[model samples]
Target chain A: MTAVTLSEARPARLRVDGRLGQFALLVPALALVTIFFALPAIYMLRMSFNAHEGGQSYSEAWTFANYLRLLTEPIYLFSLGKTFLLALVTAAVTVVFAYIFALYLWLQRGWHKLVFLAIALCPLLISEISIIFGWWMFFPNNGVLSITLLQLGLIEDKISLMYTVFAAIVGLTYISLPFGIFILLSIFDGIDRRVLEAASDLGAPPLKTFAEVLFPLTRSGIVVAFSQAFVWTIGTYATPIALGPDSLWTIGLEIYQQMNTWRDWPFASALAMVLILLVLGSMALTRRLTGRDVTHHV
Target chain B: MVWPFSQSDLFRWLHAALVTLIVLFIAVPVAVTAVMSFNDASLIRFPIRAWSLRWYLDFFSSSQWTQALRNSLEIAAYTTLVSTVFGTIAAYAFTRLRFPLKGAFYFLVMLPLFMPGIVLGLGIAIAFGGVELFGLQLYGGKALVVVAHCLWAMPLTFMVMEATFKTFDERLVEAAYDLGGGPVRTFFEVTLPMVSTGVISGALFSFVISLNEFVMALFLTTRDTQTLPVLMWLSLRSAGTPRLAVAAVVLAAAVFLSLVLVMLWYARHVRKLR
Candidate 1:
């Protein structure tokens, strides 16, 4: 009778352990990611090693010609460098402005604070296409900027600000600003409210307080925001294509054109593989610098 | 709250000035879009020549616009369904189970969150471009677009749901089990209802993001299966008109409606919890 009861209990215990239930629950998601994301990425890496045969096909012979060309080609190398630099500048501008906005939001009170937070979240929710075109319309000659300036008699004539590196930078900053602010706002919220008061009581001036207290305390958050912004800006293609001058070519656009127009699948995949590496490298570097996993922060 | 240097008048003035500038910087473009959508003049200009609903009607009437909108809606729907369900399941498994290579699995799962859409798009297109099921090509298909968007949507859903589960009370599940409820019944009657808020929020976020996403869709889809953002992008590259402004407003309307739904759901759910 005791042996029989123990046998019954063993099955019940195994069921209660939930290993089976966990397996059943996790398979669908694991399979989905494996079949789609992981497989595609692996296939892309493999394809990058194959030779592209004009138009619609690839040769079976494996080669590193695609990557070699990427290194040897002056245009491709220049675009990659340009993308990194543009990302850096865009991140700096976004982090600076967003820090100010987040600080204000953190200190404010009541309805206005609610409104400011909601408004700050707008760009984040809006489609990238909408934001690009919104700025597209705003920067041109008949745009609100020029018209308002003209009406105010600040400028004598209309000037189209479209198709400039400055315009592209502004649009990129617009898209990245809200994200940076949200990340920084959460960090700022973590600080004690009295920290600022304590700093002031210690006789530090406003600028000095910001430099010595706020900036230092939130340094990791600042780095996280900057790196997040930089990584994000690198991936985005539409803003630069629509608003940037012809001279301001980036690797994203290069990849798109190669895949779509040139139909060079091998080259495009090679470029994409390089981009993935760059992103991973930067994320690792930032993680080392901040000594934190920022996967959640952004 | 007082500023750190509340005693300094110049500092106060400058801070206010900076806030104002930042507000204007964000607000101006959205204001411009809303304002331009109403322009009677065919061109996308400011200082409203006349107010009209002409472009709104055009957006609804034009096949290019309507087809794109339909495609976006369909893809977003699938993405929302797939991501919310799978993401919830995966999140649960990650939180509850002591799996092998758990840390490595998590890092791999979340890696795509930072990946560029173009890279993901190109990779997917190359990998599955030649494949077919039932003689239907996988490339340029709406289903393919849905899966691509899922790459973006699912990880986000997973993150949110996992965070929510971290705060969840597991004793309730045990209590339900002790009362003789089976696994299935306990999941539905106890676990699900308890986590409905996270599920809803995750679903809403995925739906909205998939709706807005276009870069991947561009690479994965043909003209027939193109999404709104992809169409808008193609046009923006060549020549653009006030019609684009109308598209922007319409797309924004979809996002706003979803936002309202999520807000209402949260309000009702929070009250019930209280």
Candidate 2:
């Protein structure tokens, strides 16, 4: 009777442990995301409606003044447009370059492949500040680009590209390029090389082969890469502020200025809400567009 | 063929030229910055008239810079520890367990990774920025930054470990359980040993993510608790100097050093098993 009771109690304990153990494992991660991630986002949403009293951080009052002001302000409107354009341009440029480079990376082997892989990983691994510094040193009057052009007798006077729209785009593109490459490369790796060989054997030109075979094959990947770059570029404040001219205002910069410089939490939270909306919209769009293709492919 | 070239040859030429340009665009700036760190001069001039480790020495010797570095490492260390332990367990549950709302849990875990750092930073700063727990102010503390960093680090670790565990053999786990070993013993002695690579990789990933992250840190940190990247961002805005380049190099070095150490340890571990 003791033996039977012991065996029955042991199984029941194990059954209880199984369910409890799973919850215990999941609880820490769940609590973290809820407290730090989800709660903060909800708080920001609520904070956006608060009024910033004069000479005060904020006072408890419900109003749409922050959002209304963001929409009505001409400077804010311009920044909204500029930020969208900058992100769009960055994403487009990054995807094109990344597609070509990823194709090149895929074709290499052995140590050659390793070298290319390292190059692609550098921008991803290095801090965004460091990348900005690298380019900051390259674009200024006394920087590498000017010096190189001068030594090459390409120009009589040194030209500074620092704090320009062009510089900002270059910096943004450089940083986002690696992500595009890595994403598309992984997709490209999935396709069989024999398909390409078959195309060439059928008397198709390289351009034709790419257009008909490679493009369609990697369409989902391209969309994913483009959206990734866009999302990343939109959220970025440092790259544009550090590398671009004063005229090159982005929503991210506006958010920073509102929060730190103006000491206006309500306005800052409003801008942040807009940024989050844009990111979410893009993500939703990507999911809708790629959902079918991804499922079909998988 | 049109214009004295076959289409394939033309494509090859264009591809080669583009590849070269892209490679240079990616590599040259970092290379220049690394070289500039060794410049003896104060300004960020390219054709260096002198070469010295003055900036490197300056970076290490300066109280503000050294303090920031210490803060970064300390925060990253804590972030790695918390993220790895929790992330691995969560990932194990994801792969091995059958529970309700499993898909929702996975989605919730990954949501933070996709959110903008600015949004995450601002939200946390506003929400818990001033909150005190047990008589300790949470604002401007390393603990806040660790939590913020874990938003990204934890998810990343979970994603990686989930993939690792997906490929893991359940039979090994079954064998351990069938033996006299209990659940806790089986997990520690059997499961953890098998997925050691994933655990190590996830730890390294979180470490690096936390080390380099500054967007969130910028919102959360006071001057005293500022990480190196945050300090660098502030200083870079105010001035241009070889010291900044030294900071970049130092950051890169930290990443490489850990990677090398991990590789060495992994190699030794494998040899011992052999």
Candidate 3:
């Protein structure tokens, strides 16, 4: 509430000449979005209805075969279900870790805050591929995880967790953690720190205080964070493809496969469309349910 | 104590333990990668038998790797320039100008940032691939990737600058106008100086996004135009080598170096402003 509202600060000008100039300023952005984002999206949607030929990537005939296959075939159906489950689990786990981390950050002051913030930023600043490479180093039979366990005498022999569902989840959660922490931290900053002190002075147990005081206050933010993380995790293909077993298929990998392996452009577009819908639908539902624009939280 | 948990030694110790684990979860992988980058051996093995900068030398010497590096930098540079300029102006318009369907425009501009790279890549590739404009192929080129990157970059820049401009005091802009400064002069002299940090950070985000991004580039780039991350992804799939580790370190170094330089410049700029 302390933040300045735009309308209060910028009174509308009565002059029409400046209006024209202001409108002109938006032309470049509008043009870029229209030419790149809007047109390609529309084209992809159209491409989804086109016919697929084995020899060519796609043909110019109209058909619903792509959608028909996506809806009916057990393979595509299974991948869709898997993608949703993966995203949900990833988001849930990420939110828990991020909540704890954000609470820890909230309690800290001075240099400790800077240190933890820098640590939180590690995943964000590094490339996704590098994070995958790092884990790629960690999970192999001869990898860091195996070697460390061996040295600690915790395991009889080296074992590889690479290309497993667990490894995939670990990678997914690691990348999504920073985003969840950031969103939750912003919400935490808005709460009065003295509320916790008051609760402690009143003889409330820590668990009871958190359940009654903090949980209810941050419920909306947690929902926003979960939905945001879900939206991001659902669209990603690389981590799962790089880390997971082939049996662990998701819609993103399906899209990549359809485009790259099969060269089935129509099928790929159809899958991409479904993924887009899932993302936008989750975002819309979050906004509606919370009555909060989640975008600004980050 | 500000926190209830601070009153309990048991709770405080438990909290510290959990937070330490979380930090390690975030930090250890990066540490491992940085350490492994110097392995004298080609294979990744712990307790290095030997240590040298052999992989770094290979990364710099190989024509393929160097070409990818150049491509990554070129695309990122163009992406940074295009997105920052377009996004900054659009943010200004949102705050300062009156326009119709403003809310719709704002949503439209931000929508792309929410989209996954896979979908955007496929959409752009299919739509623009194999197409030519003015005797030039639009697909398989750095220009196309720059535009593709702007889909996410411009929106991100807009978001950052939008927040920046909202916090901005419009009175200074009015004062400039009252003092007979035109919109251009006022923007250059008065408005931009105030938001330089926001603009710089936005540009940095754009650059980093384009540099690290691969899914979109994977679809759009030919072997000739492959960026470093795309090259890394391809090379990683083919073989495991310390060279990949070196590439990871090199990429991180690029991002961190820029981040440090920006921080230093930001400090100097703030002092100057003061």
For model 2, which pairs clash? A163-A245
Model 3 agreement with the true structure over B1-274: per-residue lDDT tens digits: 3665766888878888999899889987798899999899878787688999998999999999989989998999999999999999989988986657987898888888888999889888888887999999988989999998999999999999999999999999888876878889999999999999999999999999999999899989999999999999998889879999889888888888889989999999989978
The list of candidate 1 runs beyond 4 A from truth reads A1-17
The native-contact fraction of candidate 3 is 0.76
Question: What's the lDDT for residue B53 in model 1?
Answer: 92
Of the two candidates 1 and 2, the one with more favorable lDDT, higher being better, is 2
lDDT (C-alpha, whole model) for all candidates: 0.87, 0.87, 0.89
Against the true structure, candidate 1 reaches a TM-score of: 0.96
The lDDT-based order of candidates, best leading, equals 3, 2, 1
lDDT of 1: 0.87
Q: Per-residue CA lDDT of candidate 2, range A58-174, in tens?
A: 888899999999999899999999999999999999999999899888777789889999889888778888999899999989889999999999999998999999999999998
| lDDT of candidate 2 at residue B224, scale 0 to 100 | 98
Sort the predicted structures by DockQ, highest score first.
3, 1, 2
Model 1: lDDT of residue B193: 93
lDDT, model 2, position A278 = 92
